[model samples]
Every structure is written in structure tokens, then in C-alpha cells.
Target: MAFIQIIEGRTSRFDEMQALTEEFRERSEGASTVRRGIETRDRDDPNRFMVLVFFDSYESAMENSNRPETDEFSQKMMELVDGPPTFHNLDVLKDETS
Candidate 1:
């Protein structure tokens, strides 16, 4: 089954984080197991952001942590964010295509 990894947190430096997010998008394009990703900010809390990453499977999603590009992004994100980012892994129950 497919899986999704949700990473959410508050960033003191939104601009820097945004720049890193842009890089993440470009770098992740080549991740063989990644299907897609969605990045969003809370409307009520602009500083809080969430990134939803979809992968082929749980193992694939976990592999992302070991990716050099992902590692680099993580390092920068940790520096710009407040405290540690929270990750929620979900099993994709129903994914439909039109």
C-alpha cells in the first residue's frame, strides 16, 4: 500500500524555510519511490507549515530519511524551525484518480 509522511512545525524563519522547501521540491523530483508532495501553511497560523509527502510504500518513505538531499534539507530545516519537527506516518487507505 501507499504511504504518506507528514512533517509539521512552526518556523521562525519562514523565508529561509521556504527557500529550502523549494530546493526540496526540485531535489525530490528524482526520488524513485516518491509519488508526489504537498506543502501548506495554516491559514490561521502563518508560521506553522506542513509538508505531506507520498511514497510508493512505507519502506520508500523511510528511505527518504537516508537520502543525501533529504539529509541536507533536514539539517537546514532544523536550524530554521522551532524545536523538532513532528512526523506522522499514515497508511494511504483510498487514493483515487480521476
Candidate 2:
């Protein structure tokens, strides 16, 4: 089962945030535990963004969080966000395709 983390926040510096997000991917790509990631912005409010990161497991996600690179990335993220981000932790119970 994949462990997922959803992060949503408002960022006035949307362009800067996009660049930082790419940097985050580059830094973390070595960690095979990170399965996938996606980012989206609200059409009504471009500054409002949401990012979903998928991990192989909750443990792996925790390990990623402990990395110094992740800490640096997080700090940069906080600086760009207008306010604190909201996180939703999820255990994927099922993923089905027809």
C-alpha cells in the first residue's frame, strides 16, 4: 500500500514556489521511496496550491522527513508560503482501474 501526504497552502510567490518544488524533487529523487508527486493550483485563486506526494510506505516518508535536504526544502517552502501549510496523511486502502 502506498502512503500519501497532501499539502495545501497559499503562496503569493507562486512562481518561486514552483521553482522550489522542482528543486525539492531534484534533491529527493535519490530516495526511491518517493513513488510520485503532483502539484495543482486553484483556478479561482492561483496562489492557492496543493501538492500530493506518494511514498512506498509511511516509514519511508518518515525517513524522508528526517533528511537534512528535506529540512532545508521545508524551510524554503515555509518562507514562500503566505501561511502554514495543511497536511493530510493517508494510507491508500485501494487503487482500482476499470
Candidate 3:
């Protein structure tokens, strides 16, 4: 089944966050594991950001999450944020059909 991961955080360092976004884009570009991704900032809360990532399957998502590039990117993400990020892993059942 296709899976989605939602990552939410508040950033104190915008420059570092921008760099991390670039790094994530670079790492995800050629990755066969990632299906799609969208990053957005909360309209009501400027410090809040969310990333929605999709994968072909749970296993593929886990594999990508464990990659060295992902690990390094995660580290940079941590450094750029104010608090620990909240992650939600979900199985996407229906979308367009719904």
C-alpha cells in the first residue's frame, strides 16, 4: 500500500532550513523510493512548516528514511528547527476515488 509521512516543525533558523530543503530536494530527485512530496508553511503560523511525503510502500519509505543521505538531512533539519519534529506515518487508502 502507498504510504505518506507528515513532518511538522517550527524553524528558528530560516537560512539553515532553506539549505536543508535544498538538500532534501537533491536527495529525493533520483530516489526511486519517493513517489511525491510537498513542503508548505502554515499560513497562520509563519514559524510552522510541514512536509508531506509519499512513497510506493511502507517498506520503501522506511528504506529511504534509513538512507545515509536521509540521516544527514535529518540532522540538518534538527539543527534548523526550534523543537523536535512531529512525524505521522500513514497508509493512504483512498484519494481520488473518495
Q: In candidate 3, which residue ranges exceed 4 Å CA deviation?
A: none
Candidate 1 C-alpha lDDT tens digits along 16-98: 88888888877778674678878899999999999898988998877877888888888888999988989999999998899
Per-residue CA lDDT of model 2 for 1-98, tens digit only, reads: 68999999999999999999888888778764678889999999999999999998899999888888888999999999999999999999998899
Candidate no. 2 TM-score: 0.93
Predict model 3's lDDT versus the native. Answer: 0.86
Deviation (Å) of 28 in candidate 3: 4.4
Candidate 2 accuracy as lDDT: 0.90
Candidate rank order under TM-score: 2, 3, 1
Backbone clashes, each candidate: 0, 0, 0
Point out where model 1 deviates above 4 Å: none
lDDT of each: 0.86, 0.90, 0.86
Q: What is the descending lDDT order? A: 2, 1, 3
- Error at 50, model 3, angstroms: 0.7
- Residue 65 lDDT in model 1? 74
Across residues 1-98, which tens digit of lDDT does each residue of candidate 3 receive? Answer: 99999999898676678777786787678864788888888888989988899999999999998888888888878877999999999998987853
TM-scores for every predicted model: 0.86, 0.93, 0.89
